[model samples]
Target: MRLLWPSLAVVLLLYPALAEEHNYQLAGPAPGSIRFKWIHGSICAATNRDPRVQAVMYNEDTYILRENIAIHYDAPFTYLLMGNKGALLVDTGATEEAEYYPLRATVDAILKRWGDLRGKTDLPLTVVLTSPEYLSENQGYRQFVNRPNTTLVPLDLAKMKAFYGLTDSWPNGTGRIDLGGRIITVIPTPGAHKDGVTFYDSYNGFLLTGHLLFPGRVMISNDADYVASLTRLKEFSAQHPVKWVLGSQIDMKFLPGVEYMRLIRYKPDEHLLQLEPTALQEALATATRMLGKPEVAILADFTMRNRVGPDERPGRRPANLPRIPQLPNLR
Candidate 1:
């Protein structure tokens, strides 16, 4: 009876890890759900007083945050991942002013709450970027300056290469950060911008694509470079099971190849922010089609813009939109 009780206790302690391992083997990783609704902008920007940031807790340790469209037009998404040893903050955001956008205060509150729960007073934080060249994706890097126990990562390719210890084989080689038990693989993906990167989380199977594969007009800095990056992602996803491909923005509507126009304060029926592995496959297939000719490829989930920045006037429609009759209000 004495031996039986000790054995039972051991089994009880090991059960969760063993079950998680089994689940991972069966599917990608333990799948999580979106717990919060996204904050699309309003028609009247001045009247919109929603919180500057919308936060969703994917799980106890993983959080997804987005700047309100009213706060910044880009409304880029950021992530917070906590592990036993430390935590990583992905993308500072599009805003720098605390008065207008309170990302720093919001992050600090989350950190304090997590520290209290984990019973660790001195938790370290590492700040990183998704797309270094995009101002909207990295304007908030300076917000973490002089923050206690926080490391602000560099936004340039050279410094980032050295910081991630990828200087040996940069832009082609992979880098990683061992957040205690949860390892994050940083894959260099510099097509959308010169220093963009995609993050893969081992713990939850999240593939953070940054601006590379968002549900919108995906502008390419270099088609060849973009193709190489997409190929890298395809090879990587084949080896690792990815539960979700979270992107930086949501510009397309639920309808196929239909996107919200630029500078529109209110976005009606914005597309789901989360995408599946199939979307990545489709993106690669489409991007490959635009190798030499740089024409726009209007795909169901995304539109591939061959150039960077605003390539067209705000409301100018693309070449080949599906011919669906408009609703009463739309017409």
Candidate 2:
């Protein structure tokens, strides 16, 4: 009986992880259904404020506790909107199980949030692809293509929707979606994620960068395109001061909280708080130094050319992957 109790407790603890393998009942359109749950990643918690409304705040990674509208959910992260007007979604979640990268439940959940936005005046929603990897863009075509309310904007429609079914109306690269009062703008910031698009929210001074701008690690994108993309972001930030930088993956310390981003330039705008030049310089310096490594540079290049990031190799070097010439020993 003593052993039985222990065994039962162990089984209970394993339920949630096991449940992921099987299809679980989704918390569809239920009023006041906004609930936040902690999922381990750079970002600690993802809130499902209905489907049309979602947000993610990094616990430790990137800017501390910076919140952004999460577009889709690949289990961990979800999409977010900037007010009721328009939204910039980072990743495209999986579709169906048998499909290429079946995480469409996230998108299905998103569309159901505001009921039906199709032909309903203005319910602007633009999806931004931060990284152009397989999982990032695959299996997410149906939600954007068929949805009546949301607009599908891709940098390279052929590259973004390579394996998925796509329609001719899908906007490629630069485009704009009117989100009621605000506008969601898609600016192509390739490199970090091949053909990855960085979203700019002029209303809130928020930049939704999927995996493009991580705080702790070096901003590595070996491909010239990816490197150029980050450079573009830096230039944009220098010109148009951004108060907050929202990213998909990050490693942070807090459970759940919001952090203030130091605005370097653009005068004290209404929505953003001004940051000291020193702080901004330090943050950018740290980010720049990390990516300066040869290995990191190589990895970034590989990510851009092959449209893939470093693979998880347990004990051996990743097969056929590019190797950094003077790689630093990463623990």
Candidate 3:
């Protein structure tokens, strides 16, 4: 880190605006276009030809990469943010085989090109997971192991808390990472997954919530914990302006209160991945109202249901578990 400081200082002298807060005009090309059409998987896997990983340059300093749905059903979205001194990677996608997935190769290519373009080389890379509990989201982590100048944060909750400086006020206060001048704030949002977290990019006002607040089925194990996490998110959003709520997956369809069948490779009428900032407030309200409801609350943007557990069915449940209805077909 210290080795890159001199170069960063030189760049700062040339660009004085970055010395203060650097406000980036978030999107690239237009309001909707993001490099290439998102390759929502094919109906049949045998003929699928989409790249194992699809990347879109959100901006010069930011890139959004989604694993091809054909390669993995989850096809989680991984984010790469470039800073003057270093770079930050959010989550690694599912697939593990290099011949099939090649996540690290793809990322290396992107970084090399970006470094050449910016005349910066060997910028330290830091990789962090949204939630270590999700296996598919972190499966591709081996691609980064022993890689030069990279740090893959461990999956242990204790280690993560210590690394992010949230040991004292975990799941309550915030932690941060300074990627050079850009500081991304980290908030604990554990409900859908106990180790869940949401990251806020200070430059673009993008709130990257992994599974907690996506536009899909948000399965909750503990309703009170989920509600409390949502409250924390709501309070944080009140203080910080959020531009986009980006989730890892988009299972919900265009139809309100409906999601695509689980493990379906193809989704033609899928809902948009990016949700408006108002979504946070809306989600909080809906979750609060469904705190003790017996039905699976389905909203236009998202559906709230209980995770698959012994007491997850439609019948009577313990006071702690949220009332959830029966499961549906397909998804």
lDDT winner, 1 or 3: 1
Candidate number with greatest lDDT: 1
Count of clashes, each model:
0, 31, 3
Per-residue accuracy of model 2 over 1-331 as CA lDDT, tens digit each: 9899999999967652221121112232111221244322122224423233223332111111122223323222334453344444556543423233333444444434432322123335555455546363434544566655565545465755442232342223345545544455566665554546666655445566666553212234544554556566666667664655655533221211111122111111111222222333443443355444343222211111122234322233335443336668998
Residues 259-284, model 3: lDDT tens digits: 67778799877788888888888888
TM-scores, all candidates, are 0.86, 0.46, 0.83
Model 1, 106-157: lDDT tens digits are 8888877877666656678999998778888888888889999999888767
Model 2's C-alpha root-mean-square deviation from the true structure amounts to: 17.4
- Displacement of residue 98 (Cα, Å) in model 3 is 2.1
| Whole-structure CA lDDT of model 1 | 0.81
The residue ranges of model 2 lying beyond 4 angstroms of the native Cα positions read 1-37, 41-76, 82-88, 94-126, 143-145, 154-175, 215-219, 251-293, 296-331
Cα displacement (angstroms), candidate 1, residue 14, comes to 30
Error of 2 at 63 (Å): 18
Residue ranges of candidate 1 with Cα displaced over 4 Å: 1-28, 307-309, 312-331
Against the true structure, candidate 3 reaches a TM-score of 0.83
What lDDT score belongs to each candidate, Candidate 1 first? 0.81, 0.41, 0.79
